[model samples]
Target chain A: MEIVKKVVIAGHFGVGKTSLVSRFVHQKFSDQYLTTIGVKIDKKVIELEGATVKMMLWDIAGESSAMKIPKKYLAGAHGLFYVFDLSREETYRNLDTDLFELNKSLNGNPAIVLGNKSDLVEETFIEKLHSSIATDFKITSAKSGENVEEAFLQLAKEML
Target chain B: MNLNEIKFRPLEKKTQVIVFDQKGKVLETDNTLVEVNPEGVNIFEDTILCGMEEQFLSLKKGEQVELDCIHTDFFGKESHYDFVVMRLEEENPSYGLVIYDFGAQYNQLFDLQQERNMAQIQSHRLERENKELVDEKTTIERLYNEMKDDSSSSQYILVKADSLLYNLDFKEILYLEAYGDYIKVHTENKVYVTHNTMKRVEEILPANRFFRVHRSFIVQLSKIENIEQMSLLIRGKDKVIPIGKSYKSILLQKMDQL
Candidate 1:
């Protein structure tokens, strides 16, 4: 039987969450900025050694510390992706608070921390962040297809 | 009728009767009555009548009391019954308890309630399914538009400019230019700005009729007036589009030579 797992993709506004999902799912990228309303769902199947894992990806709208994340969107979610923009410092500053709220709502599920928009950021700053953050964080460029697949595979493995 | 004239009267085999003395003691009972209290004042499923016990015992001579109650029979079957208690005479008054069978009406009420509950559940289910159908329609429509954009045989293309959809023929397009987050479609009489990438524009435009002359421009092959070393002029327009050095040979190879 194929195991189906729900993964929620969440981040702040303009943080490249949609771009990352588009790159991974469609292998396409667009420069135009489209704001997501409510939530969008996509599906992908991963082949492991003895199992095929079907991931139902829920791309929710952007949430800040002030905005309340709708609880219905997080219902029955097995994992999460908390993305931030590498070029914007404000998206990084609210990472801890957003993760806290997500954890509280999901009762502490596993999550992947992704710093996107790496194509527009300085290499030195990204390298420094890799050392400061204790968890497994990936720096990705959704625009150039950099480390996008690796981050998804890593999350899928962790969920397994 | 006389106070003692109201003796035991026979009822249907399944019907239940309980005769109460002036002080509310059970004087007699039907053969179907089971599980009577040891004191015989109240019987099985009498819980519904507990509140009216005071009024039952205080009934005066020649007075009557009538009410409806839900009751369970000796076989533990339940039904609604019209209950009437009457005091026959003033001398040595006694109360007669007569229960009218309402099993058919009670069953009809139960059936109606079941039907109403089913209707409510069905209504909620239909609402949820309708929303799903609408969502499916939207997805199909978006996919259809994308498929049309990907088609190479079509002579017309649907373009969105300023949030409005326009179905323009391929010949009307002079050339497409890439802006930051928008594409400017320069036509014969006007320029329309739309949110799209140049890569997407290339996919939508027919490859045989259009050529990617530069990173920022896709020009119609039929509309090219003349090609300079660094720039090319399009018909019916004064603007010159720069040709990329990498695309120079491809542009030349695409031309029908003598």
Candidate 2:
């Protein structure tokens, strides 16, 4: 049987959600920042331990607030990658509330928080951010190719 | 009109209708937008439709499920649609999947959204730049204040020459000349060459005492012995510094004040 799952990459605007998708899907990185207008679907087939899963990556347009995201975009989403910019404190200050609303809309779907642009911040800053947030998040840098693949693979495995 | 001769027009021009059984199998389709498979028309082949299976199944008789802003690309041309799934009430009930193409309106909305988002990004970048400028100004003010408070440490400007730190007093310095990616600090008895720029040296020196007479030269006002045509003579030195056309008026005004 062919297993197919939908995963949505969502977060605040200018949070590098599109960059992460481009890095993971195309193995390419661009310094340009282009805003996504609507949902873009990309597919990748991952070979798991005992099963092959076709992961449909739905890169949704970022909203200023997680509650502002369209509910139609979250329909049938098996997993979600909630991303935020590491350099911007405003992006993650409301992480708890945003995650609460997003999870409510997802009906308790599995999600992973990602702090992107790790290269722009120091290790001490990352530690401070971790101490401040209640949820555990992976720090990634799409520009430097840091921990991007690992994060996507982890989410794909979780969905499986 | 006779019942067999009567026909109904579609509600939309670019529309697709797919009828499915309760088991999620495609029973019939007009094949307008959706591509048909050789074996059968399985609506589940589309990722968006496949994902909405649970929602479609939960619809009761006469109930409808709407998913808006669904995007699709056919042969390199992008299109947007609004999907409505309704369950029909009958003995052998079937489901209807109606796709209404609203690509034109959605494209307009996308353009507006793009413009708004770009403007937002520009605003954010400007805000960040403004904050950085504020921080830089604060630091410069703090340094200036600290220098002003310490009288003994304030009069001397520190310059590095040949890997040695030279503390030259403000009065002893006559002028500075720009020397190829470096500045030549001319003092009373010695000319010290330092790796610096004229603008930076001018910024560090007091505005009232030191004046930039030209693009490449900054002269101490107290050291000017005589002012000539488009040039000035420094006291105790025969060197004549050419005055820039634009700075001539400002120099004359400052000299008159002095």
Candidate 3:
């Protein structure tokens, strides 16, 4: 028996949280301003662990100030996809808060730290931050389509 | 790190002279007589040899006798000393008794004071060192906790297979390996490669769990099956990772401790 899982994408404002999943499921990129108000959902049926798992991914807005997510949208999430911007320190610092709050909302939910905007930051700076946190993180440029799917795939692989 | 043998030395036999102040309490005990020129009995005489002889002659082995001991000044003043105190009857009392009082025994007081000071200094140094060892132990414990947490917690590494999230424990990861732009994460089960550099990928993995073996490879030390010279053999992959020159010594020392 196989049960479908819900994976939520969460982070600070304008960190391309929505674009990461949209890019993964739709395989498209656009310079568009679609601020996710409450929650937006995407469905991707993929072959995982010798079974067909339909992953209902929730792309939560990446606004740091919007700390509380209403219960209506915060339903039954099994995993988390945390995003952060490389150029913005505020976004990175808020990443902890995002993970913290997301964990509070969905108790014991697994997460993947996604490092967005890898195209701009140098490899040296990224290497320096490598050993900081315990969670796994990956560099992906949403605009460049760089390891975007790998970041999402790691989220599903480690959880399922 | 500079260790100069910390061995203990045995006490040596010595000839002693006990000096007392006006109060009759023994002030200074010196081994000058017992150590050298035992035949010279008069140490406070007109000549240096006589003065040495006088110090020895002033005391008799079994006689509890006090004589008029002369104390002199460096400027050649013939100061008459009242004291030579000896226990003519007792056999080796814990301390030789003061049977006589001589010229001001101020120099005797000064010498004993210096010895006391040296013992205190040695004790103070040991106290500080003990405190530092306690501090070092605390630091080691803190680091150990950090390492344990990193290994046990779930790490979200980017990968090509979406389902790898459930299969691997982040702590089981030994290292990240780089092959050009594609970084392969070699864990217990299988090796997964994604479009990433080891440097960039290292940031995503726990620093303590996955060490950067080379620019092309990062290996989990816990999972290393064997080390053949400069190469490390990971379980799954036929290809071996090289042990870098800079990291070789530290790796060897740590492996030995394990």
Per-model root-mean-square deviation over C-alphas: 25.6, 10.5, 38.8
lDDT of 3 by residue, B201-228 (tens): 7676665556666656777777777888
DockQ, candidate 2, comes to 0.32
Across A1-160, the per-residue lDDT of candidate 2 in tens digits comes to 5677889898988889989988988899999776676777777777886787777788888888988898878878999999999987768879988888889866666899999999999999999888878999999999998999999889878877
DockQ of each: 0.01, 0.32, 0.00
- DockQ-based ranking: 2, 1, 3
Clash pairs, candidate 2, are: none
Candidate 1, residues A1-160, lDDT tens digits: the string is 5666678899876678889988988888998766554455566778865788777677776655514767755656778998988765656676777787788766666898999999997899888887776655788989999999898888877777
- Full ranking by lDDT: 2, 1, 3
- lDDT string for model 2 (B182-255, tens) is 99999999999999888888888887788999999999998999989899999999999999999999988887
Location of the lowest summed lDDT over 10 successive residues in candidate 1 chain B: B43-52
Per-model TM-score versus the true fold: 0.38, 0.68, 0.36
lDDT winner: 2
How does residue B224 of candidate 2 score in lDDT?
97
Q: Can you tell me the CAPRI class of model 2?
A: acceptable
Cα lDDT tens digits for candidate 1, B1-258: 532354445544445566666555666655354444526344212332332445556778767776543333323444555566777656766577766666676667656554654464356558767887999999999998777666644578788987799888888889999999999988898888999999988987777788999999999888998899989999867889999999989999998867
- In model 1, pairs of residues that clash are none
